[model samples]
Target: MTTSEIWQPPSEFAEQCRELYGLTCPPRWGTPRRPEYPSLGPKAWKVMERLGFPPMPWQRYVLDVALEIDPATGLFAYREVGLSVSRQQGKTQQILGVQVHRAMAWARQNIVYAAQTRGMARQRWEDEFLATLDDSSLAGKYRARKSNGHEAIIWRKTRSKMGITANTEKAGHGPPLDLGVIDEAFAHEDDRLEQAFSPAMLTRPMGQLWWASAGGTDKSAWLNKKRAAGREIVERLWAEGVHPRIAYFEWFAPDDLPRDDPATWRMCLPALGFTVTEATIRAELEKLDPGEFDRAYLNRTRKSTPPQDPNVPVAAWQGLADPVSQAGPELAFAVEVSQDRAWSSIALAAAREDGRVHLELVDRRPGTDWVIPAVVRLRELWDPVAVAVAASGSPSASLIDGLIAAGVTAPEDKERPRRGDLVVMRSGDLVEACGQMADAINQGTAVHRDQAELTAAVSGARTRPSGDAWTLDRRRSLADVGPFYAVTLARWALVSRAEAGRDDYDPLDSVY
Candidate 1:
């Protein structure tokens, strides 16, 4: 066909443009919009507009498909709808419009909106939903109940109510829900919310369930399962020409696409031209890790695999254990905190006369309150060459000010940290520390005291990308990695001081 002829039809013209320039990626799998099907989407859009929230093009498209009515039954065609899109795409606003429409159009309807936690749900309901409603023309139409546990928005005439709840097994249990929404479904690890809410909608003929989120990691088992099922259903429909009562829409960049290209972003992010700008995405790309940026912005799920070799080999780590390992006169001490701040660890490193590093776990305890006092006591006794902390982008960063307040002196000049000055390590420094520690263990240049805490930390250590190198990923580690980090920092500080020709220590200067 001629180019001019192809451009004659609107759909054909759009398809040609898309094929040539890679403009947009439609839902990867879902029910296609049928013009013949009547929908309440327009009314929902009108409601949103009246409340000063206009639907974006993508939102309008989703609403039309998700709210399509069955001609025979005069009810919603889809019983369950799943929407997976990148963050900041206005999913909440679209869902809010739908909720408002359902509440106003139907009599005595029960609508429940849930988030990952009860506090988050309550906050969103109050800050976003109710705040918008109260500020708009719709304020006079409903009465809000702001009680701690009994929060609801009740329509004056219809008596239809919308409530907020946590994504627990008990969510939507008491009410026969007309609509149930689970926001940020990626946080859910299982199908507890589905099991609880799906049954509640069975009796209501017009009931619908909605799940919306950005793409998640392998830990998001429930969302992953739902996405897989949605893909399968779409494939089945394409082959057999059959329709199902489930609707799934996904806007995700294909695995093969170049992530850095703006064209690729346009294909995946529906709000690129409307709400979000390319400049904003570019800034985010530079700031966030590759895996995190993909999940948050490209709507790409992370499929984690078991590492062929652990970050630290268990056998190598175990073999380097020494029951009576002790530090010499020249010493460096380091502190680290668990990812959740539930625990903290202090480690000591010393250069032995035998040309080996002596590593020991000084102290590990629950809570952060004791860290400052413990560090102070250790400093007075050991007179160490350096006091190290992996502070940047870590929970341990919370201790920096407290350490300073307790008379712990940090280096005025980072390039040359004086003896007994705190060596605050950034991301790059931490990466170097991890590499140095790994090499020392593998080369038999380091010996540890074989403490259980140290062993557990080494065994469970995981790595995350930091620029060109990697560092310990406390979030993904199976066990508390504070001890491991602490020792790594300690060794790094000792090595750094020696390499810089600044390890001038005296045993007589020790306070103890």
Candidate 2:
């Protein structure tokens, strides 16, 4: 059978297939020749249509993959089915339809629907499954237990029940489940819940586990790992015509695509224009932060982990942009070099008359050679109070020789000290500077003129613990957060000088 012989697909779905990325399966139209086996997909589709829940072509295609039978055993080939697509693309409706079929067609197919929270799982039960049952001919044939202690839908004829459970190790412990629908699988960080539930399905020969979710962060280790495993198997299926027992279906945009681009959004969202409108998506995007919109709607995962609580929120950094480029009399400079020594950045902080700290990324260049010359030139022009350097094992250590060559001197005696033009900050002092930067942002005292590089660094910055204290985790950050560190150090120098009440602060006499 050819696509022309099949019914015309919905315009939105057709568009989605055209732009799809992260593919690792036999695409709907490109399913290769395989062994003869009876498929329940068409039967399921007909049942859904009879119940007035006619599925889209893409939905039907996913059903085919999930329902594919093994030629040898006359049962489903795949024991696990994973569907990862954007929200508002009718995933809930599809899952509800599949469960309904199992409840009606199969005898005693005990199923469980699980979500991140019990309330969410219960809500989906009442809203979609129950609503569909009520509308269909199966209404009076089933008994509903909607209470807290007893939440299930029991088919009066077959005595099979579809239960709801939260994503916890204790959930669905006693029940012998034939099918488990894991809703919001992206929210799961580990497989403890799945491990707990697996015992229920172990004895059943036809047991199936279905996972449906939008893309989540790298913190969702279990889902990400499963997806990767499924992808590897699917790739083999596409290449060698050998199908694995795990059915994985994913619809997402390429990583290089811009989140705001309509093409990227269209690729991930199969129900666009029908269930979700562009205007609604744009409005919701306006309300969300950088990664939130992409994660929820675009089905794009964050490539790396960010700290649980960041030193500065991306929104606060975005809010503190002040367009003034003027530098006040009190100026300080800070330099940051990437741990890999591939890049370095110079930042300047000025104490404005309004008592606000103005920050800017003065320069960023490859290698450490240009860094010293750039710093020296900036110092000569601005006559800064101090050039601060975080004496980390990497960047600061390498900068010591460069500073000496630039004629910037550091104090030899730390015990009885006056600050020199070069301030070599180490240990607790560097951590204090990080905290001070966060304070300035929270108090609305820190301002910037808004450079793209600086904004990205601020958004990507995450923290790591140094004993009881925390410092920026540059390695975990998606990009170099050097600009953020540099500016924070510069801000500390100016604020510390002011706090000491040193009016005639010699470049070499102020305390660090």
Model number with the top TM-score: 2
lDDT of 2 by residue, 1-512 (tens): 11221222234434444443222222322232232656787777876776677777667777766787887897888888888887887888888877877787788888899887888888879987888879986679889998895799998887888999877888768868888889888888999768877888988887888888888987888888877776666656656867767787776655445667676667567777666788888887889985788788867786664453555667787889876667786778888888788778889888776667889988877778888888777778877767888886747568877797778767555433333378888878788998888877887887898776787788778888887778887787766889888898888776654423254543322222
lDDT of 2 at 151: 92
lDDT of 1: 0.82
RMSD of each: 19.3, 10.6
**TM-score computed on alpha carbons, candidate 2:** 0.58
Query: What does candidate 1's lDDT look like per residue over 1-512, in tens digits?
Result: 11111112225423532453333556555456656889987888898887788877777777877899989899999999999999988888887888899999989999999888989999999999999898888989999999998999999989999998877788788978889999898899999988989899999999999999999999999999998888777667766868799988887776545568898898778888888999999999999987889899988886564552355766788889888878897889999999888888999899877778889989888888999899999999978878898776889988898888887888787787667788889877888999888888888888998776787678778888787778888998867888898999998888776433343543322211
Which parts of model 2 have CA positions greater than 4 angstroms off? 1-36, 239-241, 302-477, 480-512
Clashing pairs in 1: none
Model 2, residue 367: displacement in angstroms?
19
Regions of candidate 1 where Cα sits further than 4 Å from its true position: 1-24, 304-512
Name the weakest run of 10 consecutive residues (lDDT summed) in model 1: 1-10
